[model samples]
Target: MGTFKFSMKMLIRDYKKSLFYGLTLVFAVAVSFVFFNIINNNQLADQSIAVGGGTWQNVQTPFSSILSFLIICFCCFMIFFANNFFMTRKTTELAVMGMSGSGYINSTMYVLYQTFVLLALATPLGLLLGRLVIPCSNAYMYERLHISKDVNIIPQEAYIYSFLLVAIVLAMICVLTAGYLHRNDILVLLSQEKEMNFHGSSNKYKPLLYVAIYVFGIVMMFMNPHSPNAYIAPTLVGVIGVVGMIRYVLPDVIKHLKKGVFLTKRYRLISISNLSYSIQRSLLLFTLMTVSVTGMMAILAANQQNPREFVTSVIGYIVVVLLLVVSIVYKLIMEAVTRKTLFFNLWKIGYTRKELKKIVKQEVIMYYAILILIPLVYILFIAGRFIYYGDMTISFAVIFTSAYVIPVILSGFLTYFEYRNAVVKPIQGGK
Candidate 1:
């Protein structure tokens, strides 16, 4: 009991330090929930009206699945970074606890306590904020459409369930992180290495693959912008190709940092390194940006009173998807090149294979799920369906296909790389 109390106090202190990250995460989740609720509500109403009073609950499964994925993926990254931060700050303290009378169980309890308190604070507020936004957003949409909605936000249920779910998931991540720390090598805890090593480089021919994927995705996006289902296949293929190439290129690009052809080469190397890290650490962010931009274009295009209003919405979605496809492809190529450079630099700095693997694994996991999966699923299912049912076009169908398939492949590829880097590399080093 005393230990638990002490651990809870420590957890509070640590959580205070993590306030910035936690607050931002909570805000993002809240806003996303609100947006999702609005979109889901709109879709359900539309479908219900079409079916003449069919239950909205039937159509909610997909939306709920998407929400679950987002919460899990987001929490995973948050925990990874938070745990990493915690471990770095408390290595010596943890080491001392292990050496003294305190056991690993006591330490693990603290991790759980901290995670629970964080979620306890964050989830209710998120639900409340989401509840507040839904009504306002619905009012705007209703006024714009000049129609009334029969259904309204279930704030109470949403608040209770979502808060509980997210809390449990985050707490699980905390447990895993604590378990890892508890089993950490004493030597690693004693004098932890700063530098990270990586030995991979990019292939020159990879640019062609990236270009091909981008071009194909563009073609699909333009061919049938209105048909959401049609766009799925092309989007999938393009995304997969881009992810693979980026995975290959990102590490090397950071390694071969040299003066560019232009005269403004003073901070080029630093810029390149930072950009590379961002790409590797935040690929999901870039993807979300693309999805969000495209969605915005769709909404705006749909609203225009101009001559091309009808045509524009359809075209706008396609155009935005194409733009996203191109950006992702380009980023992948650049990231692959950058990673190669960074890996070589790490080697030069005498970072061990095991240490580098851990960093890369953490980074890859962070980028793949949070940046990629959550937004991709939301765009593909919720937004894709909206665009598809609204109008079926060849371009949209192609983009939708690409979007769906790409993330699955990317998830696998990134996971493989992460496992190879984190698990395999360490084992090989030990051998």
Candidate 2:
């Protein structure tokens, strides 16, 4: 009881961290519920066909299985990263506990307690939200398609499956927490965030591996083996390329920028240098942006290629909205966690708050440029196709504008807000 109370207090005190955890779980549950509903719908369609009914033949699979796989992958990745970030934030406290002679078992217990508390709260809310939203979504789809089938709001097996998946995720988090604690002692854990260092010697051959993977993915896409597999192969390859671009390509680009006369100006130098130093973290943000953009492109392509597929189009739009939200939330949280201290030190060393803001703004602009470039190029290609087909309608224009403008506006707002809170507010507070 005492230990549970302590865990609850800790969670309450760091409510922001817990909030992200809960949100991730909510996302997971919602996605899982939707997926199960999809499977159930597919089963019903199959049954209708088996009963000598041709009326349902025109009802193409609304939700692609590949989309389900992507959702699962995204949920798992978010959960792992969120949990790790929470643990990273608690490094100092954990070190203190360790120094005071807290046993490993106690630390593990604390983690389990926190996990249980979050799961207990988030699971029901997620399930309830999923229950409410998914039915409406299905009903909307049916209305759009002019289908007479009744919407299934509650699927018994789906609810059970979602709960089981959530449980498995909780178990994985507990195991990971235990392993991380067991591997690192107090001193190492305490110093974990002190510096960002890249110890690997440059290997000229690594770029070749990335290039090969990218090529392979392109080839696989052209081959077009199957539905889900086709999506997976190319996407997985693109992810590797994005990560590589961040890890290898971006740093090199920054180094070249530093050599240029333009960026060498003193005002710009700090931002460029900060970007170079924190390249790994910068890469992570960029990677998220890249993946989101790529996912959006994929979804839009599906909608464009299958004009009659209203369900696919709707899913595409939904995915784009979700990606934008995820990107904004992720960037804000990560920037707060990783860059706050560095910005603080810059302030202490004679840099003004305005200067810090400029640097941040510059960094963000660069990221936005890179993130938006690919998607914009693709959108242009799509526009070109519309022009060629003499189908450049107002609807397309509206969609293109919304898809392009909204992410840019939202990203800019998030960047400004993060810089204000993480860097500016602290400076103001110190005064």
lDDT of each residue in 1-431, candidate 2, tens digit only: 65577778888897876676778777667767776665455433433453565434465554454455565556676677777866876777678777878889887787778888878888888788888777776776566545667676555767887888888888898889999999989998797655455544276666667766655655655566333223544666766876776566666666667779647476577676665554465566455555555455445544554422435345534544564456455645555556677778888887788777888877666655666663454345434444444545547655754665676767666766776577656665554
Checking candidate 2 for backbone clashes, the offending pairs are none
Minimal lDDT window, size 10, model 2: 304-313
Model 2 CA deviation exceeding 4 Å by range: 42-63, 149-152, 198-239, 276-279, 282-313, 316-328, 374-405, 428-431
Q: Candidate 1 — what's its lDDT?
A: 0.50
Q: What RMSD, rounded to one decimal, does every model reach?
A: 12.3, 4.6
lDDT of each: 0.50, 0.64
For model 1, the superposed segments whose C-alpha errors exceed 4 Å read: 1-16, 28-44, 47-54, 57-96, 99-102, 145-155, 187-216, 219-226, 250-266, 287-431
- On the 0 to 100 scale, the lDDT of residue 347 in model 2 is 84
lDDT tens digits, residues 1-431, model 1?
86668667766666544464356446544654554454345332444453676545545443333433453444445445444544554555556666666676776665556656666777668766767666765565555555566435543544555555575657666667677776785556654323233345548677566656655664666566464345555555555545644555445444644434322443344334444555654455464444444443344323443322222233333333433333343333323433554554554566555555555555444444434543354344434545546643546545654654465356536454634443334332222
Per-candidate TM vs. native? 0.54, 0.80
